[model samples]
Target: MEERPGRFLGVDPGAVRVGLALSDDDARVALPFDTVKREKNDKAAARQVRSVLEAAEVPCAALAGVVVGLPLRLDGSEGEAARRVRRFAEALELTLGVPLHFVDERLSTVAVERTLRTLNVPRAEQRRVVDQAAAALLLQAFLDARGQETWPEADSDEAVAEGPSPGDEPAPAGPRGRERRAGARPRRKRR
Candidate 1:
């Protein structure tokens, strides 16, 4: 369990289960990490996620920030599901004391399902892993665009360089502004 620095956590928020992924130290590759079972409590779910982040396996890695999948509709409009995800993201951000960035996850699940079919993954197993796979896809999309000039420039206030150390006070309130990225639209904060 080697600790890698500068890793980013990616999340796919769901009502029943939350999928997670982690980026490499360089932020070039994304890998499926784990799935957290949600007990209908946002705070509890966020705690579970924080546990994963604080795992011994990645002890030295500083959490750069968090990337959440915003499940927008095909027409580019946010529906109830997207709103739910945003709320979850906000809660998780507060819990982890990290900045949050959102990526449009229009067909991340569909793409993961297609890949699972191509790989001949068993249906039962696919059900268990699809969310993790979708999370990885969403994270990869963000990593891929991060180095491109066309990517939307995130506000300086919204970009986190490092997370709080253990036993330290939780980070201050995050930036209210949205992160602008290429091909991905920013999620508006609900009133």
Candidate 2:
């Protein structure tokens, strides 16, 4: 098999399972690889990921880096879940000796669930597939961020300063007289 440059492995770590995604040789696109359940112990998940890296023949010299999703609250506060993610990262770093990149994953799972549902994944089977889907989504976001040439980085102060930009016009009313963004659930205002 031909080897590629910058072979990146993206991970979505969970309490019980870890989802894996792999980028193309050039590290441009990320595709879902596998979801490993926590077997006899959580060590199984780590082993499974290690196996994928080994079987892919991704040379250590060319293994560019790893991307890990960092769990955070909607308000950007770190919590217990975030702590677990940190610990997992620490362990992986020790084992892989490769650099680890963190991507904000505040709502990645929710986004992945909606995506899977739209793809007609059965409810009974979603749990089995959610983590891997999340990994793919996270990696895709990371790739898109890097692919945008000449895009200015928005300052944190301005990123959330307003509701929507000029181009973000509200979606047209639907046939049932409901106004909802395409593929998004209707929003409810808090009292």
Cα lDDT, model 2, residue 134: 93
lDDT of 1: 0.81
State in Å the error of residue 39, model 1: 2.5
- Output the number of the TM-score-best candidate: 1
Compared with the true structure, what per-residue lDDT tens digits does model 1 show for residues 1-191? 33324877889887888999989888889999888787577777887888876774753237777889998998999999998888888888888877788999888888899999999999998989988888999998888887674344555665644555558654343356543443554457899
In model 2, where do residues sit more than 4 Å from their true spots? 1-5, 39-45, 59-61, 149-191
* Candidate 2, residue 5: lDDT: 49
Note the clash tally of each candidate.
1, 0
| Tens-digit lDDT track of model 2 for 141-183 | 8878866742545764434455767788788786578786778
TM-score of 2: 0.68
Q: Tell me how far the alpha carbon of residue 136 in candidate 2 is from the true structure, in angstroms, after superposition.
A: 0.8
Alpha-carbon RMSD, candidate 2: 11.0
